[model samples]
Target: MNEFRHVTVLLRETVSALRPRPGGHYLDGTAGGGGHTGLLLEKIQHTGRIEALDRDPDAIAALKKRFAGEPAVTVTQGNFFQAARLFPHPGFHGILLDLGVSSHQLDTPERGFSFHTSAPLDMRMEQDGPTARDLVNTLDEPSLRRILRDYAQEKYAPQIARAMVAQRSAAPIETTTQLADLIAAAVPAAYRREGHPARKTFMALRYACNGELDGLEEALLSLFNLLQPEGRLAVITFNSLEDAAMKRAARQLTAGCTCPPEFPVCVCGKSPRAHSLKPVFPSPEEIERNPRARSAKLRVLERR
Candidate 1:
């Protein structure tokens, strides 16, 4: 827990953009360690309610412990996509989506979220799900290649996928070290020296196994619908794919008149639901303290 308490990226900016008020209802979609939730609960005052959601059981437990005896807070152990079903509502005043693997996940070797750590190759946000090993062991070469190419944006995905298929025939790819080593060996020498050779491959496998990107897309739409008129939504993304999705979704939702150009009468009648808030980022001081914050990007939207 101490490790996770270090620093959350764009913490102040994100919270400020949320602008929670007394008695306002709020949701923390990725309540990892309750760091941001704790702050929100404090700012929202005792009357305000917060329905915090996390898919990981351990994270939920941690949050419950951290925020014990606080009736204003309802800790839920489930994906945020279920927010609409989890609670009956006209919609919340504010919603926060911190979309990235938490520091706890990266620090814990058993979680297998980091290339520096040699664990079981499991990267599911849920404690129990089809792990990286399961995908590597069972996925055919073509599926593996597509996952790497599409999810991780790896250029040598096909070659790496082919290599993985060949290597697994000799032995089961059981551990993080095994897969990392194989990926490192498969990539070109120039790329190998630039960064962890397994970073892209691991990220791709984790996304595929957890269905993270697709889940994010669904969650974003659900969240938009769950905001009260003039309510606010904030999302923090750690990767290009996630950031791009957020950018596009924000643009589409905030855009007015979605009717086709030929439809001069505006038959589609799609009015803008939300307006974009200035995207947030870490201060130089915060980034210096936590290098991981360097990649984080925060986007905010206000329901119209």
Candidate 2:
């Protein structure tokens, strides 16, 4: 395993949104490489406890080793979506969720997250279950097209799906380079000039293989429910799909009433449970240093 050196995006802003206190309990839901966890630990000053969780075994191992003998930190190997079951007794003062693939995952060629390098088509964050190769070879043409279109919003989804199906009939597409070449050939030369033609296709496959968006709503709701009164939840999303979901979740949590306009009496009896804070974006200097931070957006909400 290579050294997990992840550049934490919007570091200062995320911590500020969390509003960590000396005695407050924190949750680093996606503790990739422990960059954010380290900052949280510093703010808490050994007075608070942090429960850091990650689905990747490599990340968990790295975190355990990094924070060894630290009485304030607890590292766990699990998905943040299953956090509700993972931590039954929840009174979290703040929770941080940096959603999407980490820099370490994309840099590792064997992980098959990047098209720049040649490796097996395995994009599982947890390193289990069906891989990208399995999905590329086994899924039917329509299903493949749907994944590309829905998950990645790829415009050439149908063409790419047809090309993949036709090529796999001859031999299994077992590597990242093979799939990249296939996608490049499926799209036009002009289209390829805009960006790596395989980028969207690869993203769709990874999302589908890991079921990334399936339980996102439930997970966000679960985290929100776990917050202590006036506690904050900070989330950093990379793409529009995730941003839209977070916005909707925040709005739903902060919505006040559902009673009819004509009915004067309050029938629903529902009150706003949370409120959204101003969103934060990376500065020009930050994006210049880390291009991956270019698309990052951080949104926060506080329990009422």
- Per-candidate count of clashing residue pairs (backbone under 3 Å): 0, 0
- Candidate 1 C-alpha lDDT tens digits along 90-125: 479888988878778877888877878678878888
Candidate 2, residue 63: CA error in Å? 0.6
Question: Candidate 2 residues 1-304, lDDT tens each?
Answer: 9898799999989987899889889999999899899999999897789999999988998899999999999999999998989999999999999998888999999999989999999999999999999999999999999999999999999999999999999999999999999999999999999999999999999889888887687789889999999999999999998888898899899999899889988889999999999889999999999999999999999999
CA lDDT of each prediction against the hidden true structure: 0.84, 0.93
Model 2 CA deviation exceeding 4 Å by range: none
lDDT top scorer = 2
* lDDT score, candidate 1, position 294: 88
* Cα distance off (Å), candidate 2, residue 95: 0.6
Q: In TM-score terms, which candidate is top?
A: 2
Clashing pairs in 2: none
